[model samples]
Target: MLLDTPVRLGIQIRPQHVSYEDIRRAVLTLEDLGVDILFNWDHFYPLSGDPEGRHFESWTMLAAWAEQTEKVEFGALVNCNSYRNADLQADMARTVDHISAKGGEGRFIFGTGSGWFERDYDEYGYEFGTPGTRLTALAEALPRIEARWEKLVPVPTRKIPVLIGGKGEQKTLRIVARHADIWHSFVTPEELAHKVSVIDEWAAKDGTDVSNLVVSNELQRRTTEDADALYDAGVRLFTLGFDGPDWDFDVVRRWLQWRDGKN
Candidate 1:
């Protein structure tokens, strides 16, 4: 049996081709629908449809979500580690954590990864290094981020959960095994099972136990049967992406119902 954790549903609100007001309304709607987590990706331009569509920055929107939402944990689905300095990223995460506290502990998940989109780097004047170099930079930055969190005044409301995304067996999975509280990836059930085993091996090598690490996967274009297979493969966190203009929640509702049944 997978981890004995309750099934959790997350929705990634792709901040592309949408207005801020459209996003705001959808956030309230999704929370009311009982999503466990809400996420936005770190990107400068739209990944789908019009490349130059209406896009918003990730962290700024996260800060807004921190203030606007009451219960659902939120962050960038995967913050690009190359975009900002490690110390600054830590401070931003800590501040957002406090902002979302609402008289209780924070509901911020520090989801991050080595960035891949070259356009974002080129247009923004940031270095678009090779994948190896980027992953190495990510490895170097994560510890600095953790250290900065410890040094922050009035530290995070809680030990903010770290969710790392990527499935590279060499660098990414090792990073996840060493530092992640949650691991997000897009893969088939078979691939996920193998990756989970790989993570366990890495964790053992690193002297860390990932038994408590949550396994997350995407839900877009996936069936309930697919979700069941993913669950069988040890995934507990399922996330669906909703893009804008018209952020429909019908698919989300069906998935949430499935989640409720699983829980």
Candidate 2:
């Protein structure tokens, strides 16, 4: 898990209970503040606060951000692989990648996961399959998604990096070993070390070299010293979450200062 990768900061601007203008402004602010990545989650309803609060769809908002921002890579924290058809998802990602490129390389990260949100599945009329089934589908769909990207009329500006979220030792890590360019999880440093070892084992079994894989973790609850330990534990990407209705960046600013010091 330890590679010579620079420490990077990301922000997950939660889309619940917020106006589009507010969300747009936050995106611009984060970009100006020099965040390495900007992310939002894919959900139909608010994860916190009022359950039926105002919320935006993920991919549509991402397309808008692709046109609006000039810098800072962006994506869903981890898109639910069970939501959309795999090929369609790839096409959407490719289009956004081109849109964000602005005549140069794009700033899109294809972060995905085997979904676990029952509410999203139930409300959307999608079958809420068992976790094992969902993961199996994800493992099956990824290759098709990559194939679709290659066959698309306008290919992506570059090979889009796949960010797989979760640390399940059996299926998720195996999937990550096979496909992911980055791994994001909220596990503790000790858990991270163990999971990385498991992931390495899976990588070896799959005959894949995952030493170049970037490790990411949440920073909202961790102290600077805690972050240092995480960095020492091989986490190069730290993400801070800002929920909507009053998206505060003061804490984010402090972390940014800490991030700058690390660099």
lDDT of 2 at 39: 96
Expressed as tens digits, the lDDT of each residue in 1-263 for candidate 2 is 65688889999999999999999999998898888899999989888888988999999999999999998999999899999999999999999999999989999999999888899999999999899999999999999999999999989999999999988899999999999999999999888889998999999999999988999999987899899989989999999999765768787788889989888
Give lDDT tens digits, candidate 1, residues 1-263: 13899999989999998889999999999999899999999999999998988999999999999999999999998999999999999999999999999999999999999999999999999999899999999999999999999999989999999999989999999999999999999989999878988999998899987889999999889889999999988899999989876777888889988999998
Model 1 Cα displacement at 99 (Å)?
0.2
For each candidate, give its TM-score against the true structure. 0.98, 0.98
What shift in Å separates residue 99 of candidate 2 from its native position after superposition?
0.1
Model 2 weakest lDDT span, ten residues long: 243-252
lDDT of 2: 0.92
